[model samples]
Target: MGRGGVPRPTGRGVGVLAAGVLVVLVGWLLQAPALVFAGTTLVVLIVAVTISLLFRTADVRVTRRFTPDRGVAGWSAVETVAVLPRGGRTSGTVRVREQLPFGRLSDAEAAAVLLVPGRASSAVFRHHDLPRGRHRIGPLHVDLVESYGVARRRVVASGVAEFVVVPEVVEVGLGRESRALGDGSRRQREHSLAGGEDDPVTREYRRGDPMRRVHWKATARHGELMVRQEEQHGLPSARVVIAVAAEGWPDARPTLPPTSRVGVRAATAAIPLVSDAFEWAVSFAATVAVEVGHAGSATVLTTPGGTLVARHDPDSTTMFLDDLADLRLDDAPGAPAPAPSPREPVVAVVSGLGRPDLDLLVASRAPGSSAVAVVVTAALPLGAGLTSRPTRPADGRARADDRVLAPDEVAGALRDSGWRVVETDSSVDVGRLITTSGVLDD
Candidate 1:
């Protein structure tokens, strides 16, 4: 529950009621006639106690049901509240406040409603797009008031779960070809088959093969053991890795030098970009993964949509999106050694285009896995494709003067290491590039 939420009233409810009861009882007993005051006091005390006993409940359980469960960063996720009163039922005023995900701010649609005995009323809340990351909902506030608003009782609701606000997932074609050259092919060559992915052929079943796949017709015709053969599928059509090298990113000291501004801005914009980028990437990844099924890859084993992480897995997609939503400038993954594996696809999205360390990282990975570096600096060149976004700075050093790499340079470097580099024009919408690539648009 949020701050200023209604708190449960204890002494206020019984305290005022008891005091009035005592005063009346004494006045009746001490009066000369006695009967007049005594009769009135008895009636008042009985009524007060009766109402108190009726509303008294020790255990209250609060739960919420959310619709759709996941949505793009800009959309809303509606939820309903279920209130279960355990000890006893009461007819009185009930106030509730629900905590929203992340920095998401919320306003109540309806307020100050009465909760009748043994009945539960539902309320809906719309979550706005806050800064991206893994947002969680929790901390319900239950406030109970009695004795004509003289007092109130409050309790806290715990154990709320988290939801990820990812960039909208969109499709990016050719990403499979992009990734096939990296994470997938390496795993296949080491563990599965060794051939161009597009080749149309099937492999015989092995120890793990299911009886359902056994080719009875083939066995009958061949007079020997035979099983279904599966076709080979190509590499991932897309691979999206949002890399935030804190050291290579911005420290954001306004007093700092000109170069610092680039890092700060790029890093600061991570959630905004990541939120949208991953959302788009997931769909792109999944669409391509579907074809891999024909290629004999088990979901997760050989494809992004499969065992590794595919479109069919909402939970996995949610996880990837959430990680991006929560991303911030963390120190470089401890002075980046060789990546965990040669097949890992690393996409360096940074603010400073002139970072040499980042360039070295990309250059190093070119030999083992394809690498892509996206620079988002204002001083960097602009226009569509690399061929347009570069020029020599006043400093005039080819590699050092402030200049965004031309597409040719990027593509050349990536190709040299057997990777591919694609960039966006500053004039173009970054979101569009992400979406056209088949990532989320939201």
Candidate 2:
């Protein structure tokens, strides 16, 4: 039974009640006692059925739990719904429906399960092919139906859970180009400094020199004191700049306000092109961050809001992706404008770039620091699949005012401005795109 509501009669029950009245009228006209008695009995049966339906006790609750609440794209996750019925009264069937984040209710009959009254039951469903973002699941909908389907009580149990799907990471060797990024050389320096492999450098001994460090051969040859000196290792730090500024996008909605930070929510009806570009930027940023971390370099991330210092550890990487998952393009009218990026070697990820200042932002932050720019565009063929090396247009000229610029044009422009560049789209295999670009290597 449902609280604070009256039970309505089923269609069949209503028909039967009407037929009983008609039968009673016919009996009265014909002066027949048998028909009247039959009609009265039929009417009484209808009332009894209605009363049974109204009094039936059904206190059922449903809770949904998802296995591996967070996962990468393409992984399958299982959802288990536990049905608990109280009062030891189970005379009905429960049809369950879990809500999808996109405002669609899951299919009903497939999720339905019979209630065994006081005993609890569970049903399982699998979610697959989820995209990279934060998805909310749960708030199970249970429909209590009588054995004959004459009445139904709708129960909405509220317990919402969140599932975070992160970008997929594909393993690959960072080739010679990656070695040039200073990680390999840094390791060699570390080895030499530790004196585990390389011979210690010897020099004239000072008064404070340790006797163990004394070079007997040098001392005997020069007839003077000599001591071994350890070399210092200098590890190069890497900085990654990801351009998430909505205004920087060629197809960005001009009417939309500038966002104060990266995680600000966008409108539900954001333009499809803008949305696609945003996703590409985020995924590309995550992939690059991971690569830098794996390279044993200290990494810093610069986005539209500000800069975030990233690390190599699993927890740090997870948190970094979590921030990316929550990244959105908001309209901030009253917020202060974002500050210009400081000079640093940057792996700039943007939807588009044509401004000179934007070019300078991607150039070296200081001498000896290298920069790479990755342009994520939505103008590529949607279903043809991702391509890292986009071909130049026949004309080889790009309109500055176009809604989206060609990747080659962007690359050429950035190159002319003194930065290494790569072009890719959202659908491109992330691992291959960044690894083969030779950006991480520099």
Best by lDDT: 2
Cα error, candidate 1, residue 276 (Å): 9.9
TM-scores, in order shown? Answer: 0.48, 0.63
Q: Model-by-model lDDT, in order?
A: 0.43, 0.59
- Model 2, which residues run further than 4 Å from truth? 1-63, 90-92, 117-119, 175-177, 181-236, 247-274, 304-315, 331-345, 353-360, 379-410
- Across 202-282, the per-residue lDDT of candidate 1 in tens digits comes to 345554444544466566666764554542233232233333422222222212221223676675544222222322333
Instruction: Name the weakest run of 10 consecutive residues (lDDT summed) in model 1.
Output: 301-310
Candidate 2 lowest-lDDT run of ten: 253-262
- Candidate 2 per-residue lDDT, tens place, 197-247, comes to 334466787643336446677677789976655421122445566565454
Best by TM-score: 2
- Give the CA lDDT, 0 to 100, for residue 273 in model 2: 24
